[model samples]
Target: MIVLPRAMMPIIVACWLYYLLGVVVVGQYEWQTRDAFDEIRMRMDKVNDDNCQIQHLGDLYLPEDAVSHLPDIKDININPVFPNRTALLHLHNMALSRSFFWSYILQSRFIRPAINDTYDPGMMYYFLSTVADVSSNPYINASAIYFSSNMSYSPSYRGFFNKTFPRFAPRTFRADDFNDPIHLERISTRNTFTVQDLGAFPTTRLSDDYTTDFYRINEWYKKWLPDNVDKRHDTKTTYQIEIRYANNTNETFTFHGPPGADEYPGPVKWTRPYFDCGRSNRWIVAAVSPVADIYPRHTGFRHIEYPTYTAVSVMEMDFDRIDINQCPKGKGNSGPNRFANSARCKTDTTEVYI
Candidate 1:
């Protein structure tokens, strides 16, 4: 080691201390930067459950008579007949994709123009066109049937249901018998001529089960469950839909649903694959999600974090449309090429060739 003069010793010590401080500063910065990056990564990976929370409409404080008039949003009953594992996975993925699909549509810019102003029929057509255009994927099986949420509040939809498609009670068969346009027109004409010919048509061809009242419709559905499930139990299986408000208050509505299933408190959920006798009349699975509307509270104008239920949107897919093949079509069928002029060694030397 080279000896330094006593005057230069202080300078060398000062320089060494400065170098140490710089190293410590750099190390701390790197550590802080690493921590910040980790935080950002975690935020990116976090799954959002913002729409999963339930909202109670009772908190709105409507009159008791008005509240009683509100329609009950029904849930799809789960089917007891379990699908194969591959089919179940396929359906689950389909349900997830549909959940996103409907969610995007509900929050899309197109819906506001339709309902924001006085229910534009032209806007309704455009909205439905958008839905049809987006759902034109080949893999999704274009033949799959879908229906929008029932908007009894809207005059256009109400007229459509009243005159075009009369609401009928859910039955074992022919729930949609009156859905035919010809039948609907006949029914409308019969209602219109009620004052003129009261006693003339004493006996009618159609069943009297059909009605425009939603309350009657709910009662009809409550009497029955999905076709495949066991309805033998004395007590009907009911699912409690609990709606919690931001004010720490909640109200529950009990409706008939499949037994042994968890409560569906407003979220993207998959119903057990079931054979729907109505409309589709095939083996189907449904993805149901609630269409929510944010409302400002009456007292404080505070915005609730939970979403209030406006309507439930369902996306159905038939099982027949999906191919549930687990393996590749021709995996491991071909042999290695052996017709080349160059000779290759057979690795199995222990065995004698035939």
Candidate 2:
């Protein structure tokens, strides 16, 4: 190469140095921006658990004489032989979508006026009363009323109930129930209800033989390990439900049964004709362990900081147990569909009039 003059050499060197510095500075800036974005994402995730609105309808209409305690109903001694595991898996997915979000979003907003205007509250109440009549868990039956009311009023996003409640009416409710029916319907109708693929997390094994009753189990657990019982051991198992929106906003929700203190607290009793063992029934009851370390798949995210999870404890009753007499007779088969083939009542010969 031809030798450059002293003055030209200095200029060339300076140009090269500037280019190198530019690359380094840009690289550093990009990395910091990415890190900042990730940190904000992690902090936003923590709100996901709190942002969720899961309403618990507990013991709203159960007669004092009925199975009032959580232990009594939980101790029904019925081994759920998942007959059609496929169906249950499907039902679980359906319930996750319909009962939780879909109904809340669609029917609560766009369809609320139609439901309220066309159907009398008494009719809805009658249907709910019928459900309570045959359900083994009165809490579940009564809770349906709350669901109905929510679907009727179409509360805004600010007015939604964020915490668990035994009972609530339109007049008295939380701020989260803001009346954003349009937005709610948009999210609910578009979101797909499917099992999320969380990478991996720590898992705690559950005892095959364990008490379902909260009080007795807590007492026994406390006594069983008097020295130092790990809090994780007392924690309920939870599932990570990841919902990816069209806008590329992803939210992961943690769903678990009631804690040891709530009534009917435990893994939902799976029964035949309901939950069958198969790929559909892949989701098992959460083991007693803290949510953070339980689902390895979700916890395995190395790049993104995961959010703190929560427990959604609601009393679920077998729809099949509802008595047909309590149901109203309607013009079509749509009204008061009874659970005639439920395993709980196999021998009942009661004729369904509706």
**lDDT value for candidate 2?**
0.27
| Poorest stretch of ten by lDDT in candidate 1 | 190-199
The TM-score between candidate 1 and the true structure equals: 0.28
Give the TM-score of each candidate: 0.28, 0.19
Off by over 4 Å in 2: 1-234, 258-266, 269-354
What is candidate 1's lDDT per residue for 73-188, written digit by digit as tens? 23233322223333434333443344334334333322234433234233244234324422443222111112212221222432222222222111111122344476855342
Task: Please give, for residues 1-354, the per-residue lDDT of candidate 2 as tens digits.
Answer: 998888898899999999999998887643323332243234324322233222111211112112111122233345332332323233233223322332122222222233222222332342343233223222121111122111222122223223222122111001122334756644332121222111111223122111122211122122111122243443433344576889998876554422232334332322211110111221112112111111111123433322122211112233233222212333322222231122222334778797
lDDT of 2 at 190: 17
Give the Å shift of residue 139 in candidate 2: 20
